[model samples]
Target: MKKSIVIFGSTGNLTYKKLLPAIDNLIRQKRLKKDDRVYLLARHDISLKQYIEDAKKQVKEMLDWTVLEEVLEFVYFHLNQIEDYQKLNHRLKDSGYTDNVFYLALPPKLFPEVAKGISASGLVTKGDASKRIVFEKPFGENLESARTINRELWRYFDESQIYRIDHYLGKEMIQNILVVRFANRIFGQTWNHNTIRNIVIIAKETEGVMSRGNYYDKIGALKDMLQSHLLQMAALIGMTRPKTFQSEDIKDAKVKVLNDLKLDSSSVVFGQYNGYLDENKIADDSQTETFIFAKAHFMNDKWRGTPIYFITGKKLDEKRSEIIINFKDDTNLNQIFSNAKPNNTKLVFKVAPEDGVKFQLNVKQPGLSDEIISGHLDYCHTCNWVGNTTEAYEKLLFDVLNNNKTLFTRWDEIEVMWEIISEIQHMNIPLHVYDDFDHLKEIILTEKGVDIDAL
Candidate 1:
């Protein structure tokens, strides 16, 4: 059966740069069937031929002309209007594709209206289970808005027919969180709070909000990163072992962690960059945070007393995303020295700029007195082999096409995350304003007494 994909905001940044390229790459790699129909729907006035050419250029000069032409032949476009939802039903039927997947790339606020329109327009057949919808995140501004959107979606589609996308969940390393924890007994045995001291997840970017200031000002770092991406990672880290690697089982484990999460108000810190107000379209009085640092804890027996630090910032020192697990130091190190310094072992999942793992171990200094120092055992995924790694969108799009919900976010997960974030928003935590990366690090060191430079 052919799948018809309708991208709602076809001309948006996400569609052009990420979605189109991902689809093209998937077709090129033969991960996607060449004949599956794709409908590009947006308000743009461009012709279908013109849009196809434009999308081709954005996909770069890949040498898969056979598959590319086949994909292009199945492509169509429509100028979206209020009534286009009704027209879409006819369009899909006329194209002989009873099954359709709608990808909403528009602003989060437009979700409710669009969902209602699709439902009212009879886009979904009464007996057809093949209709699916994919939603991009910042699912809602807060808990209430999220619930409202979920309610509207529920009116039209079953939970199984809706796919909530979080690109981070599609990353190869992020997916490997399961394998890293369950497949390796060394790490799995010590995964509890009994051996693990603290876990820190950091997503630091060197670039600031350039043209996205409007969206950034409204969503900020809490809703943008901490509320969604970091929380998802925490769930994977803290959850108990799933019975199977299936999507529902993985999600069940993740939901367990989300349900058990307990936020420490004193452990939360929000910050905004100094010149954030100077960004284009940003208001001078905007109090939105571009940086966030919080300590999240799971209330279960496996993770009690373990603080999961969630940190993210834009316009920082460098671009990096990492999960650092600091294990408890050996208490019997006094045998080496009466006052031996504690060097706790760290297991790091370096997610970006490099996709790899690093184990920081304390070893005796070579050729000297019995002194110890930290050493790194690193594994670089892209160091030697292969062409480019699969983009997050590519993996996510593949999952959607194949009806594999393993990498997609569940509504229950999103609801609980927003609930946690809404509580933090009302907690009255002050947003620390800083000039640059160094200043931000200084503040973190002073307030939290944790060394940012070391991590």
Candidate 2:
């Protein structure tokens, strides 16, 4: 079936940098039909040629202009104007396109208006699975607001027709988490509180909130990163194996983990980077936290007493996203080898900068000595193959096109995630100041008495 993709906020960074490149890659792969149309909708009018030129300047990759130009169209849209949506509907219907995808790249505030406009204009058939809408993260300011957004969306579209995208779920390594745990007997058997000492999920960025101070300040690292990406990652790591790998079953397992999550208020640490107040568009007295480190435990029997640490920050360290699972040291090893100390075995799922998996194992010394040392078994997913791997947005867009909801978040997941965030917000955790990752680590150690480095 031919599809028409209408992109709201077509002039934004996401559309230019990620969505456009993703669409171009999909075209190159022939995943999108030749008859398919991409309608770039913005508040102001811009020629298709100019839009492509601007996108080319922003997108670093060489786009397939020859193919892209054939399917691209531009539409002027006003979110508050019902007449514009009517025209859009007519344009889409006139072109014999009914399998529509409305990508709401606009801010969360405009989601309701767009939903209402689309519904009132009859652009989408309610309860129709063929027509879908996509929404980005920071879904709402809090739990109530998230519910409100969901209610407004449900007023027009069915839950099946809504795609609450968490692009992290589309990452190669993130998707690999399920296969690594469920497909492998070694990890599957021991993935519990008994064998695991601690699980730490870290996402650090060296750059500050450049150009995003306005957005970042409104919702700090906790809401922006922890509530969506980090929590979703934790759920993937902690959830019980799904009955089937289908979308609904996977979401059911993830929601179970989210329900079991209990945040440790005493262990929570929030910090703002030095000179954050001087950032562009930032208020002088902004108390927003650019960094957050919190420990949470699962209430379920499988993961009870196991501490899962969530850490994320901007302008702290090198850009990295990884999950580190530290296994409990075997006391029997010390008794067997009198000269050997217990080695803390760990498994790391490297998510960014490079996509790979690493396992820390205890190995005998090369010499005839009985000494044991730690060695790493590393597998790099992106080392030699630069262009082979699919980008997250490309995979997500493909899934949306094929009606695969496995990678997109469900509304239940969003609700539980917001509930967790609401709990943290009520904690009234004081915002501290820090220089970088090391400084933040020191503060955590001194204040919370938790050595994150060792974890």
> How many backbone clashes does every candidate have?
0, 0
* lDDT score of residue 71 within candidate 1: 57
Model 1 has an lDDT value of 0.81
Q: Model-by-model lDDT, in order? A: 0.81, 0.90
- State the lDDT at 41 in candidate 2: 93
Model 2 scores a TM of 0.97
Residue pairs with backbone overlap in model 1: none
TM-score of each: 0.92, 0.97
The local lDDT score (0 to 100) that residue 263 gets in candidate 2 is 86
Clash pairs for candidate 2 = none
Runs off by more than 4 Å, candidate 1: 52-82, 337-341, 368-370, 384-388, 453-455
Tens digits of per-residue lDDT for model 1, 14-104: 8877887787788778776766876777666676667767776655545454555565432333333546777677777787877678889
Candidate 2 regions with alpha-carbon error over 4 angstroms: 338-343, 384-387
